[model samples]
Target: DVILKCDAYDGFTSNNSDENDNVGNPSLQYDIGINKCWKAVGPAHKQRYLEYTDEHISVKDDPIKTSVKGNNTSNAPKVEQTNNNHPSIVAGKQLSQIQTSLFQSLPFARYLNLITSLGQPLGHHSQTRRFRPGL
Candidate 1:
């Protein structure tokens, strides 16, 4: 529901009020979920977290090296050259979009951590992805 509400590009509003529900808070959900998987490996610790307090975020279309032609078996990699100056656009209810909206992280927030002082992981969200890799 939270992700759905945050459909506009770089637009999200938190309504943690007396009548609304803050339980769907994305940052809290993302962190505890990732940490659980991290601790499961014993050595794989989660060192990064989603920024929940941020109100707005700007996303840039940084070029990711993807094969211009799919299913390639060539020695040299061919990538599609594109103008990376454009704002990245996620259609609706996406993780990257939601994170940017809630946390106000820099475009493609690659270097961020959950700034909390909890002894252990908190609430968990069922869906997990490789948003954060290492501590």
Candidate 2:
């Protein structure tokens, strides 16, 4: 079990309320019910278990190398030579047009609200927040 302390007032709100007085306040008692698992083991047993698991699993290759084609240079000339193919050009133009239309249809204010409400940082501030145990 853990207890967390936080500021009384909501940081995002601009309301002029008494921010310091949080004693017996109904708004401050927010409880999140998290189910946890506790295990009892010695340090040597834990180390042995970790080592056995590590030995059994195969090491993963770099994700980028696996996803991208290695023979890109050899394929480039052939792709360029087939530039006159009407189907590929038509497909590319259609895809671009669809992308532009989709982006244009999205509401800017709604997108901004969604991002802010989800605790995503704005501007040059860090995009990630350090997650604490009880946050």
Candidate 3:
């Protein structure tokens, strides 16, 4: 039996309309993957059942094979590959679709404001600097 576990974290914000936008701060997304298999023993002391766990494999490089916007192949010319990479292509398309949806639904302006605030000075006193009182 083989077992594998993977975890990932992601954060993002959009700068668009305030309505239907995620407020408070950038949202965090977490995902986990597990792969395993187990064998069951029957009441008679014999092996009866075999269970195979789901597995998720990730492709580090470009996964899309079709020329579509937001896809890995969006910028490359269509060419024939000597080997088949359909699984990767399908995964890439799904990932790209999810990212596109998230981006499209983000509130652009407020998100930009959050980013800008990070660089600005903090504290209430920072907003007011005492100039020459007599001037």
The number of the candidate with the highest TM-score is 2
Where does candidate 1 have its weakest 10-residue lDDT segment?
33-42
lDDT order, best first, reads 1, 3, 2
lDDT of each candidate versus the true structure:
0.29, 0.24, 0.27
Every model's TM-score: 0.19, 0.23, 0.22
Q: Compared with the true structure, what per-residue lDDT tens digits does model 1 show for residues 1-135?
A: 433432222223344572275455344222222111111112224444322211222112111212333443543223322232212212122554554464454432333333443433333343222223222
Better of 1 and 2 by lDDT: 1
Q: What's the true lDDT of residue 38 in model 2?
A: 9
Q: For model 2, where is the 10-residue window of minimal lDDT?
A: 31-40
What value does the lDDT take at residue 72 in candidate 3? 41
Candidate 1 whole-model C-alpha lDDT, 0 to 1: 0.29
lDDT tens digits, residue span 85-127, model 3? 3332333334445445544344543475578865333322111
Candidate 3 global CA lDDT score: 0.27
Could you tell me how far off, in angstroms, the CA of residue 118 lies in candidate 1 after the best superposition?
8.9
**Candidate 3: deviation at residue 112, Å?**
3.7
lDDT comparing candidate 2 with the true structure: 0.24
Q: What's the TM for model 1?
A: 0.19
